[model samples]
Target: MADLWDGALIDAAIWHARTGDVARQFRYRALYAALPVDALEAAHLPLRPDRPGLWRLRRQDYGARDGSSLTDFIRSQLAPVGLSHCQITLVTMPCGLLHGFNPVSFWLARDDAGLRAVLAEVSNTFGESHLYLCRHPDKRVIAPGDRLSGEKLFHVSPFLPREGYYVFRFDPGPGRFGAWVDWFGKDGDLRLQTSMIGKARALTASALRRAALRHAFQPLRVTGLIHWQAVKLLLRGVRYRKKPPQLEIRRSEATAERSDV
Candidate 1:
């Protein structure tokens, strides 16, 4: 962790563990960008916005995916929930020259008071996405200890069913970033647990360049690891669930839940 930076490179370790009939777990190091949507690019960094570079943030990668203004898209999502005026920050994997894929990305909306809401943008291998808006019932600042629950609407992993709710916890601290997700079945049993935790480094040419070297072809590597884990699960005789129909609506609000963590 380091001093807070409007834009930074997060060096993280992500992990997932299943606690059901078939037990499995995996962890890996990764890199992510904590980007300010309005100030996508800085002259001091090697990254660019909506252009080809060793590392870049393309507007088309998130929100509407139509190369639209990310700020406007985020504003629209927050308006109905009374958070339109909050500042927007996107935490996601930076795209390479050609390919990119993110299992999940976070859109944080904050006011002067503190973090007000978060939009969890989730995607699957089958090419579909969903947005889960998380906020307190009273639209108050979301404390680090608070947990939010939302109905699982999109089919993410074939190993998990669509009939569960996801309990989410986030820590968007100035010096570090962390998020946790637990899948609870309709019967009220926890099926899977996943998390991403990391320290932050200000976005700079030297910092990003070093990170890039450590994670060359990061997007491709991520996709490969996902499939590799899938192969391991299959070998373990885990039953594969079929992909269901696409979710018609893409966004829904999540409710704050009582938590002991």
Candidate 2:
């Protein structure tokens, strides 16, 4: 087993144990916290339907993150790793939008042969549908690339907005999460592929902890190499019976805005 895989599995276990997430929440939280407040504040909170053609809302607009209870807590977790920027997005659902990490999932890996074997094991052991391995939203793969290369929910969810999918990348080196696993690299403009998680924490913890202590929260910074943060956003949030502000985007326009046209 690769050291990176060991660290990834540990990282996965940590994710599951701490955040109840199978995906990369530590980095996600760091990324989100690192984002400039202005970028979030400036982006048309709630992203009301541009011209009032297709989308409608039951309430006024506000960025989901703005209303999030975790916003303040997330803001203050004292992240050891710092984030450069993370594009925050919101989608309007029948009731409310969903977040990927709300659903619990553990990490797995795909080295040279790919994670098909590991996923197959998951399906066999859990009685999970094999089709999910192909379509589940939480799956992610990291390798050298121009853009993330693998099965992405945005690719399948035709109803999602175009900007819904964004990838964060930088110069690759010893990263805050862990060093590169030789998992992949870019070739002639095409992104390559590989997958793994969990146990990564154990394998690379010493060096990563040392580096993190040395750099103090800076990403490894690579252009082609990637730190993929896969998540499985649950569909349950779409139900909006009780309302204390879920992720739903308010699309209802304000013709009643003080002065009408």
Candidate 3:
């Protein structure tokens, strides 16, 4: 199938950029931490194809308690109330200046209040995870003659499609931005490994062992909202149930599985 830009992709990136909750921040940090340095640097800009300059970016590994560096960076970005990152989305233009730039057509706004919030939220999230903040610079901004600065960094959201909580969406992948699921659970939790770390290449299918107990109890009913809230509460409550998280077996054992495309 031919690759194309449906609104969903942009929506995913936007959603990730906007919602910067605690879970989101942790997940984002995990995903970033999980990425190899080479892969991380592979991320480039998504500038308009027709633009004159070549949009490139270099993402450095963010190493802070949670997102301390990110927070400081964002705070610096917001210092100029009249000059926020979202207000002016920065891109690296190696070729040259982009003449006749149409902010409207490009959907690049001067006052992306929502985007700014997301940026801050992402910073907040990264800080909490104690994961280091990676350096992400706008290639265009650093180009010899290009304008020195504007908002260049962005956030990535983690969410798995099935059997997990729905966190914000972010541009975790390079080609298509969308939701990513933070699939961390107990160390031996297969679900956790499959989702977050990577899928099992040799998931041995064990025949269902007949347990002494066989009767199935009726599934309890709960409202979606209430169920979600309860799930969240339990997740938080169980976090400290055991001290020291065990290293992931599946992630290390299975070897990295990623999109070849």
Error of 2 at 144 (Å): 12
Model 2, span 1-261: residue lDDT tens: 323222221222111111111212232211111111223234332222322312122222222223443223222321211211221111112112211111111122233423211111111111111111111123233333323212212111111221221122211112222111111112212122222222222223354334334323222221011212211333322212221222233111111101110
Question: Model 3 — TM-score against the truth?
Answer: 0.20
Which regions of candidate 2 are displaced past 4 Å? 8-106, 109-114, 117-205, 219-261
lDDT of each: 0.85, 0.21, 0.21
For residue 175, what is the lDDT in candidate 3?
A: 31
State which candidate, 1 or 2, has the greater lDDT.
1
| Candidate number with greatest lDDT | 1
- List residue ranges in candidate 3 displaced over 4 A: 1-10, 13-62, 65-175, 182-189, 192-255, 258-261
Worst 10 residues of 2 by lDDT: 252-261
Expressed as tens digits, the lDDT of each residue in 22-110 for candidate 3 is: 33221211100111112123332222222232221122212222423322443453444333443322211111221111000111112
Better of 1 and 3 by lDDT: 1
The RMSD of every model to the true structure, in order and in angstroms, is 2.0, 22.2, 21.1
10 residues in a row with least lDDT, candidate 1: 39-48
What is candidate 1's lDDT per residue for 12-81, written digit by digit as tens? 8999999877888899988998887767644333566776667767878788999888878999999998
